[model samples]
Target: MNSYMKHGFAVAALSAACNAAFAADDITVIKIGSAAPTTGAIANLGKENENGARLAVEDVNRRGLVINGKKIKLELDAVDDQADPRQGTQVAQRLVDDGVVAVVGHLNSGVSIAASRIYHDAQILQISPDSTNPKFTQQGFNTTYRLVATDAQQSPVLAHYALETLKAKKVAIVDDSTAYGQGLADQFSSAVKSGGATVVAREATNDKTIDFKGVITKIKGQSPDVIFYGGMDATAGPFIKQVAQLGLNAKVLGGDGTCSDEVIALAGPAVDRLVCSIAGLPLSRMKAGPAFEKEYQQRFGMPVQIYAPYAYDAVMVIVDAMKKSGSTDHAKILAAASATDYQGLTGQIQFDDKGDVRSPRLTLYGYKDGKKTLLTTMTP
Candidate 1:
C-alpha cells in the first residue's frame, strides 16, 4: 500500500476507536436486582417474574434512558432465593453488595419478608411484584413496596365469594405453612367465621408436602362444602388431585399462589374444581395488558404466569422514580418512589402509607375446558 493510503487508514481507525471510547464513557450503568426461586417446584413462576424485569430493562434501554442529562444503561442482576427464607436473606445481601440501587423481586411472601430487612438496612428500594402477606409492608420499612393487594384485602373477597356466590355452609381450610399460605389461611378463616360459615376443619402442612393423602383422607371425613388451600400451585395441584382421588367432591378454592397455569398442568382434570383468586386484575382487564402480553410472549416465548405484569411494572416504577428524582442516588430515588403515581401496565400505580397498592383489584378465576377463565374482578 502507498504511504498516503496507509496514513489515511490509520487516521480512520484512530478516529473510530476514540468515538467508541467516548460513547462508552458517556453512558452510566445502573444495576437493578431481581430475586426469585429460579429452581425447584415453583421455578416457572419465579422465572416469569425475572423475565418481566428483564423485559423492562430492555425496553428502557431501547427507549434511551437519560437521567440528569447523562445517558444511562440499565442492567438486571437476577438471583435465585430458592423460595427459602435463609437463601432470600443471603440473596438480599448479595444484591446490596453488588451495588444495585433497587430490586423488583422475591416472589414468595415468606422470602420477601425474610429479605426485607436487608434491603431496608441498605436503603435499597425493594418493590415486590407478588408478595401478598400484610406483614411485608406493615414492617414499617420505607424502602419496601409491593405491587399487589395484601391477603388482608384478598381473603375477605374470597370469603364472601365462598359464602354468597358458592353458598358454602361448611368449609375446610388447609395451608402450606409459609407466611403467604398461613397468613392467607388465617385471614380466610377469620373472614369465614365472620361470614357465618362453619369452619369444619383447618389443616397445616408445610410447603414441600407433596403427598397429601393423609390430609385428604382427614378432610374427606369432614364432608365440607368447600376446601380452601392456601399455597402455591406446586403443592395445591397435587393436593387437589389427591382430594379428588379420595372422592372429596367439595369445590376447591385457592389464593393467588395456586391461581396459576402450573396448577392446571399439575392438577389436570381436577383443576376444573378449583376457584382461585388473584390479588390483582386479570390481564384482560389491565390498561396495557394486551399489548404487554403480546410483547411478552414474543420476547420470552412463554405465556405470562401470575406475576410477570406486576414485575414488569415494578421495574418500570423504579425507573420512573429514577427519572423523577433526576438522579441515581438511592435515597432520592426512594423518595420519588414513595410518591409514585404512574400508569403502569397493571393499573394505576400508587402506594398507600404501608407501601401497598392503593385501591387494589382482586380477580376470581375458575377453570373452563382446562383453561383458566376469569370469573370476576372486584376491588376489596
Candidate 2:
C-alpha cells in the first residue's frame, strides 16, 4: 500500500482503540505518549524535552495520585520521531493503538501539526511543550494542548522591538521550509510589515542543507539593516558563521528557535547583535528565575535550554488538569484542561479562545559584548 494509505489505516486503527473507550474507568493506566528527536539531527533538543517530562512523571508517581480509590501510575511511552513529521504521525498512532490516556511531546510545531489529528480522532489528549503553531489548537481539536507561546503571540513583539528598540528598517527573512519555520516566518514578516519596516528579501532552506553561502550571498546583496531567521538554531548557527565570513552588515533578528546556548556556541562572536523573542522562561528575569535556574543546573549539571522549563510545565499542566478533573478519563481530562489557570515554571499558564496560551510574555534577547543579554519584553 502507498504511504498515505498506510498512514490513514494506522490513524483509523488507532482511533478505534483509544477513542473514549475507558470513559467509565477514570483510574485506568495513564499512558502518556512522548515523541521527540531522540536520534538523528536534533537529538540534543529531544533529550532535553524528554528529561523534563521524565522528571515530572517521577514527581507525579511519587505523589501517589489517588483517583477513583486507586493509585495512578503514569506510564510514559517514549518514541523517537527524529524531528520528522511522518515519524511523528506514526508514533501518535502507535500510542493511540496502545491506548495511552494522554501525550506530552512532538518538540517541533512541524511534527505536532501532523500528529494532532490522529490524537484528536483517538480522543487521546496531547500536551506539547514546544509546538508553537497557533493552528495546532485552533483546528477544533479538543485533545491538543501546548505550553509554549505561539508565533502569533511572539512575532509582532519581535518586529516591534526591531524597529522601535533596535532601530532597524531594512530587514530580511529566512526559514527552514518546515511547518514551524515557514509559519513563524510568515508571522514575523507580517509583523515587520506592520512596523513600517520592509523585508528586502525572504528565503527558505530545507533541513538537509548545511551550507548557506548562497543564501548569505543573496542577503548581502540586499544589505538589509537586519535579518530575521524564523528557524531553529540547528542550521541558524552555521548560517550565522557563514554570514560572518562574508561580512554581512546586518543585525540578526531571530525568534525563539535561536534563543538557545547551542546557537550562541555555534554563532560565537558573530552573534553580537543577535536579537530574539522567546516564550519567556521564568528562569531568567522573574523573581523565581534564579532559583529555578540554579536548581536545574544543580540537578542536570548544565544550563537549562529553552524548552526544558516549557516541557516541564507541559507535564505539570496535564497532571494538574487530571487532578482537577478528578479522573483520567479522556473527556474529563479535556474538561479539566479547558479550565486550567495555573502558574508554571514558564509563567502563568492559561489558554485563550483558541485553546492556545493567552497573554504569554515574549522576552527579547541580544548578544552584546560576549554575553546574551535581555533586551526587552512585551505581550503579543
Candidate 3:
C-alpha cells in the first residue's frame, strides 16, 4: 500500500509541473505604444486617438489572438505628448526604449513628423491616426505610416469646395504657426488662389493663444466671403467666437483639427458659420461606424471627437500585420504593413508607395444646430 501511494503521488507531481510549463510557454505579451496630447488644449483629439488604441488592444485580447501557435495578449503603452514636438520625440524614445513592438500615435502632424525619426532609428512601425501635414510620410522612412489623408489632398478639396459650393470669392486666412497649422494653411492658401479666389489677407498666431482680435480685426476690413483657419479646435473655436463677436459674417473654414464636436462646445452659436474638412468619410457613413460608436461610448463614457476610429484601425493594422507575418518583430510588421488591404471603419486602408493611404478621401463638414453635419466627401 505504501509503495503504490508513493508512485501515484510522484506521477501527479510530474503532470502538474508539465502543465505549468506548457501554460507558461503558450502565452506571449505584445506591447503597442501610443502618444498624443491627453492634457493640452486639443487633448480631446489626442484622447480620441488614445482611446482608439486602447479599444483595439482590448478588442484584440477579447478575440484571443493566436500567433505562431501561442496565445497573444496585447498591451497598450500610451503617453501624452501635449501636441508638442519636443515632448513627442521624448515619448517616441520612451516607447522605443520600453521595447514596444509598434506605435499608433502623435495626433498632430508636427508631433508625428518629429517623433518619426526616433521610431525610424529604432526600426519600429509608427502609424499616425490623424497627422495630415503631408511631410510626415515623405521622409523616406518605411517605418512611418498614416491612416488618414494628407493636407496635400485635403486643402485642395476644401479650397475648391469653398470656391464652388460656398462661393467664397474673397478668402482670408489665419494660421496658428505650428507645423500642422502652417503647413495646412500654406496648402489651402495656394489652392484658394489657384481656384480663382482672392486671398485678401493672411495672418498667423501661436497654438496657445486665446485671443485673435488683432487678426480678426484685420480680416474684417477685407470683407472676406470666407476665413480659413489652419489650426486645431482649441484656437479655431475661440477664433470663430471672436469673429461672431466682431460681427464678421464670413464662414470659417479649417481642416480636421477644427472638424470636431468640441467646436460646438467651444464656439456655441458661432459654430453655425463654421465649415471644416476631415481626412476621411463621416463616421455615420462607414458600415462599422454605428457599432464602433456604440462600443466606444460604452467603454469610454463619451462620444468620439475625431480620429478614434482611425487610431483603432491603425492598431488593428499593426496587429493584422503581425498576424500575417506570425511574428511581432518590427521589421516583419513594417513589411506586412506596407501591403495592408484591410477594410476598417474608415474604409479600405492600403498604403501608397510613400506610406500614405491610397486614394484617401476628405470629408467636408459643417456645424448646424450645435452638431457636426457632413457636407460632402471629396478625393484628390
Question: Considering every candidate listed, which one attains the maximal TM-score?
Answer: 1
What's the residue-level lDDT of 63 in candidate 2? Answer: 78
Estimate the TM-score of every prediction. 0.99, 0.88, 0.94
Query: Number of the top candidate by lDDT?
Result: 1
Pairing residues by index, what is the TM-score of model 3? 0.94
lDDT of 1: 0.93
List per-candidate RMSD values in Å: 0.8, 11.6, 2.9
> Which pairs of residues have clashing backbones in candidate 2?
none
Q: lDDT by residue for model 2 over 95-116, one digit each (tens)?
A: 8898777788888888998998
Task: Give me the displacement of residue 270 in model 2, in angstroms.
Answer: 1.0
TM-score, candidate number 2: 0.88
Across 166-285, the per-residue lDDT of candidate 1 in tens digits comes to 899999999999999999999999999999999999999999999999988888888999999999999999998899899988999999999999998899898999999999987889
For candidate 3, give the lDDT: 0.90
> Cα miss at 176, model 3 (Å)?
0.5
Return the candidate ranking by TM-score, descending: 1, 3, 2
What's the lDDT for all of these models? Answer: 0.93, 0.80, 0.90
Q: After superposition, how far is residue 8 of candidate 2 from its true place, in Å?
A: 61
